[model samples]
Target: MTLPAIIDALQCGTFDREVLKMLRDGGYRCVTPTLGFWEGTLESLDSLARWRDMERENAELIRIVRRADDIRACIADGKLGILLGYQNTNLLEDRIRYVELFADLGVRVLQLTYNNQNELGGSCYEKEDSGLTRFGREVVEEMARCGILADCSHTGDRTALDTIEHSPGPIAITHANPASIFPHARNRSDRVIKALAERGGVIGCAAYRNITPDWACATARGFADLIARTVDIAGVDHVGVGTDFSYKGDDAFRAWMRMGRWSRQLNYGAGSASAPGAVSKPDWLPSADRLSDLVPALGEVGFSEPEIAKIMGGNWLRLYEEVFG
Candidate 1:
């Protein structure tokens, strides 16, 4: 989850607040990512300055997770652990060596591209992805050397496949959907999804705008349902939770996303689901224990508890161990 979601839950929504309480109450720990905003040579802050400030300024149910043991300890002690991450390579800018710097900063994962093309490679929203660029190839190599998992969530199809096929270590699609179900440049094709699983990689199914079965997803159950569908396609052990929740941005931000602020027309001005069952809002940020509710949803589809566990967070844990340990 992103810092915006955390801050919102802690301050705005009672239900969200209770959701966190329920997770801890149920003995399941919530682990968050440190947030890869305001990164780069300290100049790129102009792009994500406000959001980064929210993460740094706001206090909430967050614990900075910088080590492998930190994750283990979070689960053991019943606290939500955070894994810092970057959604785009903008922060890295021209510094490919910065991949190692981020790794040292405890950035466990990185999405190569965001909504548009960048120095690394084309995004899923790009017009065409002709595999890895020279710089992209180097970035891939650097990430692997640094032992930080590469995320192709927003990468173009060709680039995504090229990186996965050539990666020296396991790579992941941190958050995405099946293009077969929902045709989208941002979604993964079945072939790509299967290839990722074949290499001990996990696909983090996203529950956001156009990523869902219908127009908008308003409930965590709906997101879990999508996850269950992905498990059916890729198997339970090959998929996990990577809800790409960024709820703090307003309508202007939405227009910027759709109008191609990063790339051209990347976001499409879609709103997220703030509450369950909302028609326009996509409930991207669900309660922390929202993962647990996936149990019954999957059960309705005939998935066992153990399988559900893998989809929830077990598989993610395994990948972290394999890559980081």
Candidate 2:
């Protein structure tokens, strides 16, 4: 009856005491929270500094994960591993060398683009899919050298394919669903999923209701079905769960996430501006802690214990070992 060690591929918030308790009580061994979304270099540095202070204060509750072994260490100590990540490369700006700087600072995953095009490449929200630019190719090369896992969660399809083809190692679409099941611009197509698996990448199926076909009405079984569809294309080893849970955000923070000082007007990245509020989570899996509830739901969809273990956490552990080791 014991549960496997769970590593959430993406949880969207700066962890506070209550959030850490929720994750710990909920049985999460590790969680990847973005250090920089739309933040620049100085801002990201500040964020990391704050995290260091948090770790120092709550050493028993959580520890920062630098290597793949660090994840195991956290589990052994019964502490949550904070695998530092970035949802965008805006922190890099025009400087490709910052890849190493961030890597040295304990950042293990970096997303190429958010909702808009940057120096690296095009985003899903871009009017024209620019693919991976020359600068973006250079950034990918630097990321390989730095040993940081590349993520294309919010990137354009062409750009995601280009990243997979260009990277020396496997990349990640750490938080996204299959567009085949639900045709949102933020979702990945079957072509992208197949390509990702062929290149040894992992796609962490997200639980954000706005991206699902059922929207706010999605049930845990429906989310499991989405994972099942992803497994059909990518196989179980190349898929996992990224609930995309955000705890410490009001409507203002939500607005900042969608339109990060980029536009004077509201730019609803996934939701419509007309219906302005935070996107609703599924009733069954409302928080990251409820991730364990999906176990039976996955089973209902015919996933065996080992396969459910892989989808819950083992596959992501393998990926972290290969890429972060």
Best candidate according to lDDT = 2
Least accurate 10 contiguous residues by lDDT in model 2: 210-219
Off by over 4 Å in 1: 1-40, 43-61, 215-225, 255-289
- The residue ranges of model 2 lying beyond 4 angstroms of the native Cα positions read 215-217
TM-score per candidate, chains pooled: 0.78, 0.97
| Candidate 1 accuracy as TM-score | 0.78
For residue 218, what is the lDDT in candidate 2? 62
lDDT of 2 at 57: 88
Pairs that collide, model 2? none
lDDT per model vs. reference: 0.63, 0.87
Residue 34 C-alpha lDDT in model 2: 74
